[model samples]
Target: MSRKVIGIVMNGVTGRMGYRQHLVRSILAIREQGGLPLADGRTLWPEPILVGRNAHKLKEIAEQHGLEHWTTSLDEALAHPLAEIYFDAQVTTAREHAIRAAIAAGKHVYTEKPTAETLDSALELARLARDAGVCNGAVQDKLFLPGLLKLKRLVDSGFFGRILSVRGEFGYWVFEGDWQAAQRPSWNYRTQDGGGMILDMFPHWRYVLDNLIAPVQSVYAHTATHIPERVDEQGRTYPATADDAAYGIFELAGGVTAQINSSWAVRVDRDELVEFQIDGTHGSAVAGLRNCRFQHRAATPKPVWNPDLPATESFRSQWQQVPDNGEFDNGFKVQWELFLHHVASGTAYHWDLLEGAKGVQLAELGLRSAAEGRRLDVPELTL
Candidate 1:
């Protein structure tokens, strides 16, 4: 019976994740579905202003979508009549300035990860938002993932009773495109552009663990870049300065140790990549991005750790695929809907800016520990 129009000013909306995930899959998708359903038979529709620096490109996008609101100036967009929320998908290095400006303008925020470049800076942003008394959040998209959500279900249901440890293997060959077209963005391979595996992925893992598995207490890590050079679009070769691979071991608050292997160098092999192997004292589960299965030993398997002897037999065949829990949409859309709801009704969403900052903190410490060659204690933030 009532409609609340939450205006969202989205910065850096023309970039890859900004365009595909936030704009198309999340916002426009919500609009296409006639806005999100409300509890009392109402609906909330977001009035989104696409903000970017390129005038021609912004006009092209607006024309393509028949969107009336598009602007080249961030300040002008923020000053627009209907803009209420400020969303940023800008590069990590650019996050702090944009966020400060947004907070000063008295708008709520939702943005991509590595919320700021370092732990201290990220925490500051969180505090600033709180001081300004605005509902602040960051994109923790992994928690909305269907497979990971199923894994969380199994963990919550005591199916994996007394969890032991977690192992994550996430990678695919990201070609430098010297011989062919490059598979990933050139910024992802350059440190100066705020790119690296430790920064990029450990944030995702930190939240995933806290949400589904456990809270990380300490971390030890080492980072490497196997391929040190890449050719860009302009046929210029740049020395790779970011870590292409990261191996990290995290001890959870409950003492469950997790080893996460993230790489841009490894070739894809499995049905869909990004698998997590979660083991409990009574059972073990392996989850791919799209599929998850588990095996309950019912007891314990009697096996000796002998390299010479034949490895355990028929272990893989015992596990069964877990059925999908419910109808799922795009993970990004799930987060978007939750955010819109929070904006409308003030409902609590677990993955707020602080949680996102924790993710950034873990990443900051992971890389620091790698450089220092020692396990680092993660400090808790009050804000």
Candidate 2:
């Protein structure tokens, strides 16, 4: 069988999402599996060179993974003739510069969401990638989650006839560091560091709504900094300037209404850390990170509302579980494989830098809506 080795420059993977999801879970997993198979009787193997500012950490990670390349000099990595793709999972604030450098170096670009801190910059990056004639992509990992995949299947199969509304609940209690230690990085609590619920998550909501249900036409949102202060990783306290919670209402194309609540201060009461419930005229389904449950219109139970009486019906069990018809791979890994195929074989990929810019646009609009306390129409973005 023919084989192609594609060298990738992996940056900012020393961070949480970068380290776990992109580097270890995705690229490394792909390498472990003997690379991705192709339609033309060929296998595309990835040769990833870890790039980060921390020399010691990079060396440690490379050694741990039995990887041969790790470097502190991004320019040096970019200069490598074998490196054709530059992947960034850096902090949101640092993404634009690194990506621009990679593009200038004529490398295909792929990165984690919210392509840039602002919509303008995000658009500029998209323009640059197109001008340079390089294949580019942005991470929309949520689309590949098993639950969301099943939800998409149901939607495609017309099970949810005339989808009416969608409700998304995301987040869980994040430790304040003073007591149990904060679960997230301290940079996430500082706005200057590109930390905030609206900026971080609205991009995700944008893509999810646009692809799964419908394109978001408008947004009305309320955002808050519920926790004003938190302890840092170094055992120091700092003011939390970013919004810890965001409650948003999105109007989608085809008149579907979607409401989503994202908060780090809230406690979890659902089956997963994130869940989406879609209601339609014919059926209703709730999908979590890994599972989906549904109740058809014919099977939905009717109960009389009695505030004075204790309800004895098993409401939770009334919905039937959506069976797992096939084994699912890690979401991040799946996207990586698709991207590799796109790079190797010129396959059609919909999630480009322009799509990433759309996500940034939504976040910007959401913040504006929250600040003005009004609904805002989302203008269509074009190349």
Candidate 3:
């Protein structure tokens, strides 16, 4: 079988998510597995040319992975004839310019979202890619999660007939950098550096709700900065100007409603860091990152509200676990492979730059809704 090696200009590998998920788990894992097989008895292999700001860190990463190509210059990396794809896992602020440059260089673009800091910029990127006739995509990794996959299966099978409402809880306490090192980077809490819970997470919520449930019609949100000050990496305290917590109620098409609360200040009390419970006419399901539990209308228990009576029913045990019918791969890796296939063989991919732009739009509107303290309608995006 013939083997095709596609060079990918991988930007922002020094960061945590970039380093661990995209670099090691997805791309390198594909290389380790002898490449992805194609329909024509061929193999599609990825050659990642590391690109980042820090030469020392890039060199260290390259050597650790036994890779040859490494460069700090985007122009130089894009100039390489073998580099057909440009992948960006950089911060939100740096993404738009890099993607624009990639589009100008006639390279297929794939990036972690929010694709741009604003809706206009995101749409501009989409328009540029379309005009350039280059393939583009944004990372929507949550859809491929095992729990979400099972939840999707139930949705597709009409398990939750005539879906009514969904409740989602997603967050964990990010240690304010004084007592202990924060799990996330400091930039995540800074507004000037493209930080905030709304900008960071509304994009994810957009795609998840749009794909899994229904299109979001309107949003009513309230946001706050629960933590006023936090220590930085260098042990200096800085004002946390960005909102750390956001409570949103989304009105979906067909009268479906979804209420999701995202916060970095809250401690976990559920089965997973992120979970969504979907309730419908026929049954209800609660899905986490890897597991989904369901309770049918017939099996659902009835309990009367009594302030004096002690609770006896084991409510948690009423729901049955959804069995893993098949092996589940890494969500990021799966999307990477799909995008690779799309680039290689002209495969139909719906999650393009336009889709990414929609996500940006959602975030913009969500922030506006929070500011106004009123519901805002989600307008349909074109081009």
Candidate 4:
């Protein structure tokens, strides 16, 4: 019945993802719910100290949230005596240094993925966090999605029975900023800003595959910059130097082959913007961000491949929708609560800096595979 206030140094809240998902939907939501309930009949209340390069934006967000602390100086925020955790959701290029500083300051760290631009730097961050003995974690929120959770349940129930393959389709057309305002930031299309489809998405695929299906063993990829130019927020034209699309084939540890296509130029044709279809010997399932449908081997439709005849059966109707047995909260919020609990009670958290480094490794190997036009084996990292 007592409450313990935990100060968290929240950096990069000015960015879109940082503002919406991590700050508003997760941390602030938890605060509105009377903090996170601990097992010892106490509440772990989170008080975030917003930090970023944009002093105006930081001040604005702090005022809007009715928060008392907002600072442009990371040093000042880190030096706060109550600051137990440092959370980063900044642009990829700016993440490593801030995290290093946080580790050196002896604060527990949590961050969004692509922990560093390269595998070496990412591993170094992991090593530093390990050596510092801080409770560190990287965001892997996709694993907490309702559809993926249901898919994991099916897998755990042996419904897949000798899983065979996975096919993932993720992307939607991002408008060229000149004609229509782009949904994503212009930095996402620039190579120098640590942006590209491979770097942005391969890390996600890494964790999803390793945790839900099997560990990735190798990868073959091809990437392209479909749009050559785009306008920035200031209405100035800039060359798009990063890949907008990436097609990859991954081999998993259990011999499962996963083919994924990520693109910003392709229009969405599926039920959701992102979907993964997993096939196994006994059954097959298609899972979107919110829904999952499955077809047993016996119920699968058989279609004739005659080009002359008209198709008669409804292929989509043959699958059964998976029932939602429980209410699902926001995935980001769920992870935030878990990480908070880990800090408060020494709970075991699997998605550590090492797991995040694996993601960076996948992205680096994927890019190399695309450049060399050859399959690259993913070597395990030790630290």
Candidate 5:
């Protein structure tokens, strides 16, 4: 089999998501497996050049991985002719400028969600990439999760006859950083740093709802700063200027309604950190990050509301667990493989920069709906 090496310039490799998901689990894992094998007996090996502001950290990561390339200068890395792909997992506020530069430098760009801080900037990036005729993509990793994949299978198989509504609960109690250090970055609570539940999570919900359920037509949302204060990384206290929680109601194209509650202040009481309960006319299903459960009309028990008598029916026990029929890879890694294939073989990839812009548009409108105390229409972004 013929082998080809694809040089990828990966920025923000020191960040949590970047380091863990994109670099270690995805790219490094692929390298360890001898790269991705194409259908035509060709292998595409990924050679990543770690880039960041901290030279010491970058050097450490490169040395640990036995990778020869590491650089503190982004421009110098981008100028490398072999580095055809530029991947970003940086802070949301810094994404636009870096991506624009990558596109201008004639490199394929792929990045994490909320491609830009605002819809306009996100759209500009999309247009710029299109004008430059470069292949670009954004991370929509949740779609490949095991639970969501099962949910999609059910939807595709018509398990839920005449789908009605979807409810999503996503969050875990983030430590206040007073006694224990916060699990999330301090910037996640500061508005100036492109922090807030709406900006951070709405993009995810937008893609999820649009792809799995239906196209979102409008949204009504309410946001709050449940925890007003938190300590920073250096044990310094600061006011939490961004919304810690958001409750939103979305109207889908086919009269389907979706309610999603995203919060960092809420404690976990469910099966996973994130779960979606979908109810329909014929059946109902609840999907977590790794598992999914379903109850059809034939198996659903009749339970009458009773205030005086003790309830005998076990509602949770009624739903049957969906069995895993196939091996599942890491969600991030699956997308990475697909992106690599697209770059190597000109494969068809639907998730482009325009789709990323739609995510930003939904976030911008969701925040607007929260501030205005009204349901705001989501207009289609055409370009």
Candidate 6:
């Protein structure tokens, strides 16, 4: 079978997510699998070149990963004849400049979410890519998760009829970088670095809602930086300028109210990175990042929600762990292969750049709402 050589110019490959998720797992894993099969009996694998500002880090990563090509100069790498795709996982604040350069180089572009920090910048990038006639996309990894897949199945099967609402609990206690290693990048705690819970994650909910439940039509949000002070990698305390916690209420077209509580301040008291409760008239379902369970009205114990109830285990047992049914892969990696398949074959990927922009749009509106202290209308966009 013929194979398309897809050379990927990857910027910020030395960063945690850039190296781990995009480089080693997505790109190298595709090479390890002998490329993804196309619809027309063809195959495609990313010939990835690591690009970053840190020479030592880039060299070490490439050496450890058995990738021969690495470059500190992004311009030089972009000039390579074989580089058809340019990817960026740089810091959120720096993403636009790199992606804009890639678009100028006539390469198809993909990057991690919050396409740009501002709505206008994101929309402008979309316009540039569209005018250039090149494909572009951003990472919306959660929609491809296994647990979400199960949740999607339950929702599609009418298990959650007359869906009432969805409540999301996400985050664990992040390290303060004083004694223990910080769980996230230091920039995430600073607003100047394009860091904040709302900007970082509202996009995930946008696509998840748009695809699975309802398109977000309006938003009312509140945000805060609970920990006013944070210790950096050098153990120097800095004033936290970003909102580490976000509370958002979204109104969908279907009247399915969705509430999200995102944080970097809370300690985990649950079994998952994200837990969702979806209650419907016919039944209700709860799903996490790893497991899914449900309860139907048939299984209910026939008790009304009371103000003075102590405890009950009847409805609890009805919710059981979803069985393992198929081979599982990293959510981001799965989406990457889907993108390759769509590019090499007639098959198409469900998530695209426009969908990615929709996510960013939600975040943008969310910020506006938080700032103005009022609900904001999300203007619809066209492809």
lDDT tens digits, residues 1-383, model 6? 88878888989888888888888888888889898777667778688888888899988888887887889888989998778888889998889898999999998888898888887788888889889988777788888788888889888888878988989888888888887878888889899988999988899888888888888889999998898888888778898899999999998888999998999989888778798888899987778876888888887666677778875656566676767589779888998887666555536555666777787899888988999999998889865
Could you say which candidate leads in lDDT? 3
Model 2 stretches with alpha carbons more than 4 Å out: none
TM-score per prediction, in order, is 0.95, 0.99, 0.99, 0.99, 0.99, 0.95
Model 6: runs farther than 4 Å from truth?
304-315
Clashing pairs in 3: none
Question: Roughly what TM-score does model 2 have, to 2 decimal places?
Answer: 0.99
lDDT of each: 0.87, 0.94, 0.95, 0.95, 0.94, 0.84
Model 5: per-residue Cα lDDT over 14-103, one tens digit each: 999999999999999999999999878999999998899999999999999899998998899998867999999999988899999999
How well is each residue in 131-185 modelled by candidate 1, as lDDT tens digits? 9988888898878877888788899889887888999999988888788878678
Cα lDDT tens digits, model 4, 1-383, are: 99999999999899999999999999999999999999999999999999999899999999999999989999999998789999999999999999999999999999999899999999999999999999999999999999999999899999988999999999999999988899999999999999999999999999999999999999999999999999999999999999999999999998999999999999988899999999999999999889999999998888889889888888999999999999999999999999999999999899999999999999999999999999999988889
Pick by lDDT: 1 or 5, better one: 5
Q: Which of the two candidates, 5 or 6, achieves a greater TM-score against the reference? A: 5
Every model: Cα RMSD to truth = 1.9, 0.8, 0.6, 0.7, 0.7, 1.7
lDDT by residue (tens digit), candidate 2, 107-144:
99999988999999999999999999999999999999
- Model 4 has an lDDT value of 0.95
